[model samples]
Target: MHPIAKSVPLRLLVLLSMLLAGCLAESEPVEVAGKCGPRDLTPECCLKQNPGQWEQCTGSTEMVETAKTAHSVATRVVAAGVTATVALQPRINSAEHRGAELAVDLLLRVDKAIAQCVRRAEREVNDYHFDGRSPSRELCQQLKVGEQTTWAAYLGLFKHEQAWPCLRKALDELLPKKNYLLHPRFRHDGQTGKWEFLDEQAVKKIVSEQGWKGLTGSIEPDIVILDEKGFIVHVYDLKFPCPETNVATWTRYKNETWKDWSQGDLYKTALGVTPKLVSPREGVVPETK
Candidate 1:
């Protein structure tokens, strides 16, 4: 290789190392809940559950992500404390403009603020990116990512109206892991109808009163599958925040909305349950304008 070419690869390696080992982070309150992604498997957790995930975790995206999740739970020494959620207020000229693209791509550093957020230890959310140029519903587009849809994020809380299905997926994904459930936090839309997770005070109440079963909400727990007799059996949906409400609040997104997190059960009925998950036939491409 030419001298310059040899140095080019070395320089690239050094820059990549910095991104993995030295990026600065700040905590915020908008963290979502139960954010177990493909990268959530910890070294021990990974090896214990399925070694393939850990051994194969070689890419930059996978390694950086796993270490981060493990750090959050590992950081909290005391069993109980004020719960925190990491939030990101992305400057979304249009949050739904992008089809299924992720939040990690931004040409500008300032835009980084809008990309990824390591929120409440319960859930990690990657904000959706639609358009930085404008916000118009004519630009109203479907924001999806496999099982998880990318609705325009409600700052500081889960997009409950759009978060239930994903939460169900989170529960299914993490169910086999014991520690993942021990000191769990519920992630859902908040009192303000935005992304948010369960507060510490509320979690203590669950343990003191309902125990893990209470982790399942008021809903009788039913799968959203459309197969004959339903695919899975029951699902006591998850709603973050507490259980109380103002009568008027019930009208905004219908009683089903997580507008008031204090309610006993937020999953009485699936809003968009049409037998099959109503997804587009084709993958979407978000417009940048």
Candidate 2:
């Protein structure tokens, strides 16, 4: 009936309309898939999911090549909304780009360093104390505990005395003093699991010589990587399992501002980076999808 439709064969017009409909459906609104990899963020999805916060969509890429393409019809399209992907072959010539590269390199090294420290700690603790041998009958008797009980107590102390020091020393050697934060404390906002770092004085004020009574307890990450601007770019937590074969997992807070939340989820939301878990046996567990 239409003039354009009359110009073409009826079957052809119907096929053309069907094709147009399919093309239109492709650009229709969509929700973010929430399937982006841990370290990978799709700009369009981020804009869709977090309406006003566009900054989260950038910075993962060392260098960005702006593609002047059509305006993104919706935020959910991966290639639309905004576009930045890790340059397949990035040239690290600029100082700004260098800092990002270094941060990534340091993180990779830290993963290896943590695994080494934990393994060494286990070996050193066993070698120094009993040469990997169980406590003698006489020693257990002297301690007034059964051998199994004595061993369990020793394993508990092993983490504090051996693993803690070993990990701290290794990190000190690997990370530049100004670039990495060790055991940095954060205060949580009551409404959200989001955390903001506490300055040295603020930390001291809350945790006096007496106790941390009445105040919400702090969340401390084993290590936090700070970029040149001092923004926390990455987080890591050392998990030393006594048995060496146990699965490494994120800690879950039970009370206060961070109640009912897992540490990994909180860190990701607050820092905008997926926290890594390091253990002697697990090395660095792959990031969960």
Candidate 3:
């Protein structure tokens, strides 16, 4: 009928058109093969059906509603300037006030760090799914130095005994699988002045003392590995992101920041072992000599 159609074979033109249609279809968001109902609204089904709205489909309705309500309330509060404060406060302040302000800043940083790690993990899971592999707990074992350091910073902000479990999980996820036993919140007995491996009683006994609290509460190491005989073999300090500086500057910074009772020095001193500093970006484990 047409000049181009006449010039080309009809069968070949039809085949090319079909191939183009197939490519277009493949580029589009894949739709679920079957109908999705409430009872069978699994993540896989929801993702296939809605693409990006899987959360709305798969998340609990009650929990979603609750979250929406809380978000609305938070938005109003933020808008009303109820929690807003000027940053032009007096430079000179009481020691307690300064400490509290520093703690708040650290808490905010920790929250950001945790959020970044969670997002990265979610992306990794998505990639694994795209590669036709099911997400596994092994995904947790792929934490980089930055993630581990952020996790450690987050753990250091909390003083409660219950937070130790979280520390344990973080350590379990980040540490190398070297068959060594891990003690997340390892502490020494104040009475006998002896190191206790995986002992909560020892932690409780020393948590109350002012000196012990000062030593362990705000700056405890993330993990300590012990041999079969319950002796400390390696101490790890998960530090904040260090700036890219010359060797001398970096060395000075480390020396000043990781002085006595800071970093994992307290743990190392108590256990009579040198502590290793783990880089948050590269995951380098260099012993602090």
Candidate closer to the true structure by TM-score (higher is better), 1 or 2: 2
Q: What is candidate 3's TM-score against the reference?
A: 0.31
Ranking by lDDT: 2, 3, 1
Q: Total backbone clashes of model 3?
A: 2
Candidate 3 lDDT over 92-188, as tens digits, reads 1122322111145543443344334433332332333234333333342343222221222111121111223344455345432322232234334
TM-score of each model, paired residue for residue: 0.24, 0.52, 0.31
> Could you give me the TM-score of model 2 versus the true structure?
0.52
Model 1: lDDT of residue 85: 29
Which consecutive 10 residues in model 3 have the weakest lDDT in total? 23-32
Model 1, span 1-289: residue lDDT tens: 3322222222222222212221101111112223334564423223323423433433345444544453333222111222232231111112333122212432122112111111121132222322222223332233322212222212112222223334334534433211111122333333654323344556456556854334332222112211122122122222222111111111112123234432222322222111111111111111111
The clash numbers for all candidates, in the given order, read 26, 0, 2
RMSD of each: 20.4, 27.9, 23.8
lDDT digits (tens) for residues 194-221 of candidate 2: 4566555454454454233323444556
